[model samples]
Target: MLDSVRLYLRYVVTSVRSQMQYRASFIMLSFGHFLSTGTEFLGVWALFDRFGSVRGWALPEVAVFYGMVNIAFAISEAAARGFDTFEALIKSGEFDRYLLRPRSTALQVAVREFQIMRIGRLCQGVIALVAGSLAVDVAWTPGRVALLMAAIAGGACLFSGLFVLQATMAFWTTESLEIMNTVTYGGVETAQYPLTLYREWFRHFFTFVIPLACISYFPAQAILGRADVLGSPTWFQWLSPLVGVGFLAVALRVWRFGERHYRSTGS
Candidate 1:
């Protein structure tokens, strides 16, 4: 595992250097990434302008939710960028090229591409996180701070897992990517606010089905010292992020299965 991690780091560094070589295009793409995601904050502001709060969650509170999901997704998107473009690999038969290599296909795909532009999204999330942390009057403690970081880590795992799953689908569905986008990208847009703002059914799907609430909503409530709407126990809130690790595990398992399927069927 240590060697694999070292190899992954080398791949990431090489990818960064390659992107840096195209200085002008790289800068424009980075700016575009920043601007596109930065627009979401405007939507949040617009919502606040019309309604004071969404289900009693104030703007600053929502910012916490926003920041958490954004940072998580940004990290996931950056690391798992290979999965995002997996469809193209399938179409062009480049996935078979990965198969010829000795490394794990999942790791190969993960390191195949890195979306450097998503750094813009990370910046936006950091800005929101800092602003929201200042706006809210939470009496911070060491443990609470640790839990917040854990939750973000968990959220990142959850999202990366989702990306893996999305890519795994290409083993069967090689040409289309629309449906998975709804879950991966749409999930990001939906989770940017407190889950309580949505209906019970939507909450149930996102919570029990995708487990988005486990990564963001429940943990944010715990951080803020608020009563959870869905009756989540305190223990669950603290531990929910670990579910993300599990989610990523499941996705990787599926990816392995997909790889086997591809090998069995490929020429």
Candidate 2:
């Protein structure tokens, strides 16, 4: 396992260096990504600007949600770019090369591509988090700080699991991406606001089904010191992030099952 980790890091470094070969293009693309995702938050800001608040939640609180969710997603999208593009590898029969390697196929697929350009979205999330943290009057205790970091890490894992599952689908069929995006990207958009703002069924879907609410909403409530309008206990709030980690573990197990059942495209 330690050796696999080292090899993965080596693969990541090589990928980063290769991408940096065109520094100018990378910088511009990163900026473009920043602008693109930045516009999404702007839309949220516009809603708050006009309505003052949604379900008694102010803009600053929502900003925290926006920030954390985007940060988690950006990390996943960058780290899991290989999984996101796995369908192409399947179509081209490149995945067979991974099967021939001695290392874990999952590790090889993970580092097949690492998107450095996602730093743009990451920067945007940091800005939003800082602005929200400053505007909100929460007494940032050490526990809260730790919770914040845990939430981001857990959320990233959750999103990465989604991407892994997305890739695993390629072993069976290639047409499932659009549906998966509804869970991955759509979850991002939904979790940006307070889950209470949505209908109960939508809230439950994110909470129990995708567990997006576990990594974002429940933890954000604890971080913001707000009561869960849906009445989740405090202990549950603190421990909710582990749900994401668990989800990822399950996704990986599922990936292995898919791998064992995989057949080559025979290209």
**Model 2 lDDT per residue over 147-227, tens place:** 999999999999999999988998888775778888889889999988989998988899898999999999999999988
lDDT of 2 at 202: 89
Q: Considering every candidate listed, which one attains the maximal lDDT?
A: 2
**Candidate 1 on 1-267: residue-level lDDT in tens?**
999999999999999999999989988987898899989998998898789876788899888889999999998889988888888898899888888989898899998888787888999998998798789987689988998899889998999999999988888877666789999999999999899888889999998789998889999989999998679899999999998899899999999998899889873
Off by over 4 Å in 1: none
Candidate 2 residue pairs in backbone clash: none
Worst ten in a row by lDDT for model 1: 169-178
How many angstroms is residue 128 displaced in model 2 relative to the true structure, after the best TM-score fit? 0.5
RMSD values, in order shown: 1.2, 1.4
Lowest lDDT sum, 10 consecutive residues, model 2, at 258-267
Candidate 2: stretches off by over 4 Å: 264-267
